[model samples]
Target: LAVEPDIWFLDEPFSALDPLIRREMQDEFLRLQDILKKTIVFITHDFDEAIRLADRIAIMKDGAVIQIGTPEDLIINPATEYVAEFTRDVSRAKVFSARMVMRPLAPDEKGSLGELLKHDVKVQEFADQAVNSEDRIGVTDDAGSIIGVIDRQSVLNVLVGRESAGSY
Candidate 1:
């Protein structure tokens, strides 16, 4: 079927597929989104799939929307115990973005954002590189402007869940 609605509401589009095919479709869907950039109202019960596909996720239970947040926000600061339990087994480094743990650049670190990563990068994507570098990794904006910095320690904190609540 060919539809051109302004918004796409996909309810468990991959539910019936085998796990391998579902994963392949997930990858293909993500690739399509990178090009289409459509406003998609994708519905799924799989937390891992939701985390993988969403820029923001709205979780519902018993037909009521329970919480809404990015993957990192939901993982790092769940709104309730129910939400916490849902995120408990997620590898935080793979879920949290650089924006969640980055600090403002110190005076001595001016003009250094080019030395590291963009603010939107996932923490796990750069963890190894950050750990091996002597200085903090710089997070930048689309305009090539420095926004924040993240150190190996901060990245490690998220990996180990050592950061106190509300620290992000």
Candidate 2:
């Protein structure tokens, strides 16, 4: 894809899409990135999406970068909590990979639980599902390694229950 495009600028490629399709496109975009690591200058007004895709996100203001860093860096040490608050809405467990959050699964750990969501997907995504499952949700890397397990109940408490209450 990169070799063909001297420069590619998609103007809100998913802007017109319905929310569900837009989401599908976002996932598709991530999948494409695996095969083509292009230097892209994707533009979007959505902070959540920007942080999701960017290796180094530049939060722009008035035609300049107000801050630029990896998602974790920005979240943990926002230039200000304003940025932190913006990031807080995004579930770190979902957006970050197993490599970022996972401890090595013990050798004795065993069980073929059902399919877990992608490690790259936000934990907030699993909040509802977690509430229903008594067992831990497996976390896997892109290489398909069973790196860790997410405590389902914990995710529900953080992403839904506490999060909604904290917003008030």
User: Among these predicted structures, which one has the highest TM-score?
Assistant: 1
1-168 in candidate 2: lDDT tens per residue?
636774456666777889999899999998887777666778887777777767877776568777788876776567865676677776665554433443445666538455565666665566566667776667786887777766654565454424332221
lDDT of 1: 0.82
Model 1 segments more than 4 A misplaced: 16-20, 111-114
Per-model TM-score, in order, reads: 0.84, 0.62
Q: Return the TM-score for candidate 1, rounded to 2 decimals.
A: 0.84
Q: Please state the error at residue 156 of candidate 2 in Å.
A: 2.5
Q: Which ten residues in a row have the lowest lDDT in candidate 1?
A: 110-119
- Quick one: how many clashes does candidate 1 have? 0
lDDT of 2 at 134: 76
Clashes of each: 0, 3
What is the Cα-based lDDT of residue 6 in candidate 1?
68
Tell how far residue 77 is off in model 1, in angstroms: 3.5
RMSD of each: 2.4, 5.3
